[model samples]
Target: MFKFLHISLLLFGAVFATCARAESVLFLNPGSTQEAFWVSYSQFMQAAARDLGIDLRILYAQRQPEVTLAQARLALQGGDRPDYLVFVNEQYVAPQILRMASDSGVKLFIVNSALTPNQQALVADRADRVGSLVPNDEEGGYLMMKELIRLHPPVAPGKSIDLLAFSGLKITPAAQLREKGMQRALAEHPQVRLRQLVYGGWTQQRAYEQAKQLLVRYPDVSLVWAANDEMAFGAMRAVSEVGKEPGKDVLFSAVNTSPEALQAMVDGRLSALLGGHFTLGGWALVELHDHARGVDLNQYGGRDRQIPLLQLIDREYARRMLAMGATPDYGVHFRKLSAKGRPVSYRYPFNLQTLMR
Candidate 1:
């Protein structure tokens, strides 16, 4: 009986030790919970956290820079400091939070958006800044434009294809990178001409208003490219109001996988859609989980990892995705994707295909 009791006690001790080693992560979401993109991003991360046995907490910043900084300050200075803090450089507010996190001894990871070159210089020597995992926004932009141009080739051999673009806030790195991508695609295709590029502030109403006037100003423009789905929808609305068909008369392209955008594509309204970046948060968690287990992330990728997270969603792809349901079933084994589960030479291929498989 005494021997049996000893074995049971040892098993209990092992279970307790395993529970004690579980890591906690705090994510300061830069967007409000109401925002579909951010909500989906958090949901995928939660799924990953559950699979990896991580304790995850999220705080919404309502897309305000001041609120983001305030939340970071409270989380960093208060008791129950998390083992890691994940955040984005929205509106360039991450520098302040990075300093607070460094002082508080919390490791930091940036997602969605990365630090500016200047900010990178400031934190280049900080060991606590684990790394950044961002989508290839430039590639996303390039693909959007390239697809839009393909869908609507020049009307004639000599006639140039007139284009108009709607970009998000100019300050954000994602927007700037996307714009660069659009420019790169434009450079490659000499037959396409950019009539005007305007900032939509990432809002449907703003893009709608801009589109109304731009369509009149540049009546010959047939290709419209937006940095996000919301702006693309807005542009589509304006095109309809101006008595022009969106998908046929004027082709439109956007980035994001919102249900509305996918449905629009299925219905033959949206021309081109690039999406799947919403999985970044979940992929980031996989990296953090691996790191917590003493695996070096640098071996898989450098300190700043920019992977191709976006894919051009075609009409059939959109239909299939909608059939799956509103929320995507990541169906991914977080453990297998980690460093411990993968081979020594395995490179992380975190993309839509991974989730789908």
Candidate 2:
């Protein structure tokens, strides 16, 4: 946001800017309990806020829009009448949330989900919304599929290839978008057969259960495309339990570059990963910070509806990075502080950083 780097002048500016009295931010996620992604999100925002000298509050929900809406209303009535309200998604309960934010005069930022065009109309164009943030979930799917194709090409003519696909939450847009990305790859490579697609709900236990069931149902499945890294890790465990080498026997691809997931890829226990939520979460927090500072999301080259960076790190590359002991950062491959909201590749001046193990 480039606002108030000098602490001496910060108090004076703060008092006059209406933001002087310590700005508050309310972060609402669907899951009430802390999970992997939200943990990273909380850590990222906490650090970013410290750096920017702002206060950001955290809240949890049970994957219900109602819970988020309730929290939004409570925030306004409480002492934390935050300057901004951020939600994991705004689709299912956008109307309710928009009304609450409007009543409270809070800035809105959608991280994982957004309002539909119809819902947007209900917002009366005063939704307090800045913009939305999401991991390149679908783009990650595309990159994973591309890697799978590279590893395994159709050999025999009309070869009936079998694959088991694991989906994220059945109803989330991420689940659908990831499914479509994999489907796009399958269409081009006729040998990559989709035999089963089970909803894993983004949990290792559920994914493991589903993997066990799919193994029994389709024993000859060639590859697996998990909607998320955790699900892929679960399937990897199942494959190992069944006396099979995961990467060597049946290639696996997944999105969301969790550190453990990337380590598995390095160990050759899992194959490749596409995109990641860790850095994206931090980046989104920064964007929201700017928005709360009166910066319009449409300004400063907005990344509206445009594809974010989609990283397709393979086992070899992951291994190299891990070997070097390099921890990736939010701006790992991103060039410049900001860019126009457009899909750009990291194949240029800023190559993937290799750690020196």
Candidate 3:
């Protein structure tokens, strides 16, 4: 009757509306919003998603691996399953999340975190993992060492130049790779002596405490190396309190140039930095969009998703890159996608050497 037709029409309209709703993406960010690096990355990803006409939902893990795993699981188990997921691999949970995504059929992409060989093997045959976008961390680490040695060359033959390092969390692969590069660089420089390597847990406060202890223990420390800018600043603070001038009496260098770090570099408080990894998140969104649209860039070629490091030696380059941040104009690389959202090749448009210029 007329009543039945009215109910049928209403149901059909509801189903149609649900079907027409825009696809959404869920991002699991590793750090708290309080940190500049994580905040910048999250903002960039959101901006890119908006520009690409995709809805984005972000969850912060506050640097806790357990929290990251739980948040991802909760999001996936909820009634509203996102069409795509973007996450960085947290310690001990990368495989679990990957398996979950694969089984749930959610398209997944990793950004900012490198996969281990075992993880790579596990994901090699999986269809859900579109690919990863990680920085060439080894080169980044090598560049950091190169810059440090270039600015502050070896001391006289009788005198030894002692260097201390504040490393990131032990569980992360990026940290491991960067450490590897540092080792490689250190091997070539016999004039420099690595006094100690301390775990800073990738935070300013932790680095501050550790640097304080180390400075008292090794008063003759000639240089400090840190895995990230936050830790570098902390180490710098410690060095300054003890009447040592960074970049003068003592030299310091770190990875990832925050605005503050760059300013310090300009002022001669910090020597150099290796960055350009922060853009990976925004670029990953573009790749995810393409993947959802049936255009797999990885299918076409080799190592297209791996990003490289950009070494910022002076103030000018740092200022420009910070200003560029995660805005739409910064993602010129993604503009090459066709109307169907496929690129001609898998090569990314950015690199360390090119960006440094």
Candidate 4:
């Protein structure tokens, strides 16, 4: 085990050995666990929690900001004081949620979504905050588009490739950041024309309906980009139903390489997928564990650290990830898995490492 994690575990052992009370964590998920995005996140966290001997409670906001706020309030009012509050900021509820955690003096850790500039400044000096963990979404967006352009070169004599985008909720920060990245790529490539962009609310069914409408409106669209894999899957179905081959006549690209989506990429259905973000929630719990065990991640570093993305540009990488399967055990690298834990890296960099099996 790394020195910092070893010290953390020693502290945890010493404290629990005397107290014998289990540590509890409250996770405020922005979406439902039934969704592919949340399903992977929750599953990984569950595995990590079981190994860490921590009591974990997950509350879904159903993609509603108000529901998140209500659930957060209800959790705070309960008898047990959550040692850590692991949350995702959606609908701009970060300020209120942070305020609640700050007033209650609970350790706060954010996942999936980054805080606004103002919110970050507010918590910059707070000792109870462990910072946010987010995927390189902007970079993921840029890479997907860049790969698409590489695969399908522009036609000669100033011919342009028409493009359409299926975005998540416009209000979500992750969606906005991804769109900005897409726009940046588009700006660089004048040969790619963006016909239209629509919000799919981060769901496949919604994306399917919206993509069908967009395809009808602009049947000449050449490429369809989705903010997430589920939406990409939906867009592929719509493109196929409209009598167009997904990877041939029209192309598809997205982020978050779910199992089905990764297999689809290997099968030539999706063009590109940048994944490994499903570990955000689980990783946050790991950080929180260290923080609760007397390791000051604050003294160690700042917030909004970016975890590296897994780019499955071809079948080889997709097959490697598929072999890793559902229960990702990346936590073992950070925490001691046995009496003798493996060497770990405590420095939280944006692109820490390539998460391959």
**Against the unseen true structure, what C-alpha lDDT does each candidate score?**
0.87, 0.67, 0.76, 0.76
Q: Could you arrange the candidates by lDDT from highest to lowest?
A: 1, 4, 3, 2
Give candidate 1 regions above 4 Å deviation.
Answer: 1-14, 326-329
* Model 3: worst 10 consecutive residues (lDDT sum): 333-342
Give the winner by TM-score: 1 or 4: 1
Where does model 4 exceed 4 Å of error?
1-21, 121-124, 299-303, 310-313, 326-333, 337-357
Which numbered prediction scores highest in TM-score against the true structure? 1
Please provide, for model 3 over 1-357, each residue's C-alpha lDDT reduced to its tens digit, 9 standing for 90 to 100. 999999999999998785566568888998888787887677767666666767889999998888988877876777778887888876757787876665676777777775677877776666666777888888878878878888886577778778999889888888887888888999998788898998898899999999999999899987788899999989988999999888898889877756777677768788877777766777777776666666657554442356554455576776676565534445443435322433555454555443334
Ranked by TM-score, the better of candidates 2 and 4 is 4
**Candidate that beats the other on TM-score, 1 or 3, i.e. the better one:** 1
- Candidate 3: where are CA atoms >4 Å away? 1-22, 122-124, 299-304, 322-346, 351-357
**Considering summed lDDT, which 10 consecutive residues are worst modelled in model 2?**
347-356
For model 4, residues 1-357, the per-residue Cα lDDT tens digits are: 599999999999998785566678989888886687787778878877877777899888877888999887776656677878888878678888777765675777888777878766775567767677887778777878888887885698778899999899878888888888889999999989999888988889999988889899989887888899888888888889989998888888888757888888898888777777787777777667666665655454545576655354577878876777743564345455221222234454323142442
lDDT (tens digit, per residue) of candidate 1 on 32-132: 77767888789889989989999999999887889989888888999988989999999898889877876797899999898888987876568888888
Structure candidate 3, residue pairs in collision: none
Estimate TM-scores for all models.
Answer: 0.94, 0.80, 0.87, 0.87
